[model samples]
Target: MSDHPMALIYGGTPHRFPMLLVDSVEELSEGLGRALKQVSANEVLLERFGDAPPTLPSCLLVDALGQVAILLLRERDGGAASVWYLGGIEAMTFHTAIPAGSVLRMEARVLKRWRTTARIEVKAWIGAVPVADGFMVLSQRGSGSNE
Candidate 1:
């Protein structure tokens, strides 16, 4: 909540629908932020594999973290003309399964930043339990079109 408009934030993002993992941004400032993702049984991924347990995919946790990282970067740069891409992930660790109906809280911080790339550390939790943590690299490239 850095006083930036939600409409602008959403418009800056490239993801849509099932790919937009971030449900809401809770906190945003400088190079740090927190975001939320509510896991529900109706999610598209849950229905992709018939009879699959209603567990939130761990990969989605990473995706959510990446999305939040982009939000932070975008806010800091005032929606710069760039496209954020998931360039790398490292030291990813999962501690528990995110069951349906759980509200996941993710925290991310920019550990390092360069002209075209940012290294971030992210952690996820459900209530009081830690679920996942990792480091990710986001590459910022010139936008091909107005973002």
Candidate 2:
């Protein structure tokens, strides 16, 4: 869809609309990546909150960070068509609620990598305000069962 370089990266993956949270990639390197997610007032997820000012859910914020981690993993794999799964999350903290019409700036960095599993640290911000931060463990499909 978009002509941005990350579009090609995202296009090669299995993520799609409604669930694909990462909107754009600002930077991507070997073990780190930065991305953005624009929260719209009409977001389908906002419907779940009823009349709560259309704030983005905390879970989705973590998901957006995971998407960035996946992008980093995808880039590290040289754009290979590999499926990655979120195995676990640790020390996650939600500093504040994110409201609609806010742009989330997310960053993810690989902390360690083993045979089929990698640990990543992720954080998100709204302008200068930190919204969330956590560690995520991801495992590649078929390499081993994460469960």
Candidate 3:
């Protein structure tokens, strides 16, 4: 493991939850990364309403992709000192819901990079079946809030 403090996910607060589902970093490179999410039925998403639908939400997939970017940032430099904001998400498609007890494998490839902005293609799967796929545009923050 690198010296970067693997905080898992960086965007959770006193009230936020689902968006922090990143389990770990499996593989990392300068501009690409593969991440994982080990799902347990005890997650907040499954327990949100005593049975809303036994599946992982698509929103969580975005979190996985975002974590890939964060990992790339960490792998590039020591770690991201400033926040990386997700500027845009496009071509997102959800084909299946990752249920509990499944291992979610996520991979992100750097499509383009220019100083302060980056484009990435993200895909996530459980076993042989793909669950989510999307393109995300990220911007490196200089000195501002992600509001």
Candidate 4:
């Protein structure tokens, strides 16, 4: 856990803010990763949803998990550049609705990896409270095979 700033992590990824869901990495290793996202009322998604009590969207949570998976893949590949795409999601369960102004912590672990595809399991928490978990399949883009 280097506590590397978001800028440094950004250098290792292709995401930019308003789209770069994870703010900072809390922990990162070859097969595991943990990151944070501070949900705010002024977030674009919340603004887009409009007029509702600011609830964090579940899709954003999944995207946060995907970002962690990308971080893990980058770490595993020693910062090799590859386009990673979300291939599929499985066994996803949402425990509770996440509200805006909450800090979301996400953790992901690589479950398996093949030639150009990796399977990861991820979970989200809000200050020690579990919110969601799921398994996702990610594939390196332009790998020459279609799902």
| lDDT of every model, 2 decimals | 0.83, 0.83, 0.71, 0.83
Worst 10 residues of 3 by lDDT: 7-16
Model 1 weakest lDDT span, ten residues long: 1-10
TM-score quality measure for candidate 3: 0.79
Clashing pairs in 1: 1-28
The residue-by-residue lDDT of candidate 2 on 1-147, one tens digit each, is 456765754753567888888888888888889988999989888635555788888888877888888888877876666778899999999998888899999999999998679999999999999999989999886422432
For residue 147, give model 2's deviation from the true position in Å.
Answer: 16
- Candidate 1: Cα lDDT at 117: 86
Reference-based TM-score, model 4? 0.87
Model 2: weakest 10-residue lDDT segment is: 138-147
124 Cα displacement, candidate 4 (Å)? 0.2
What's the number of clashes in each of the models?
Answer: 1, 0, 0, 0
TM-score of each: 0.87, 0.88, 0.79, 0.87
- Model 1 scores a C-alpha lDDT of 0.83
Q: Kindly report which residue pairs in candidate 3 clash with one another.
A: none
The RMSD of every model to the true structure, in order and in angstroms, is: 3.4, 3.3, 4.2, 3.4
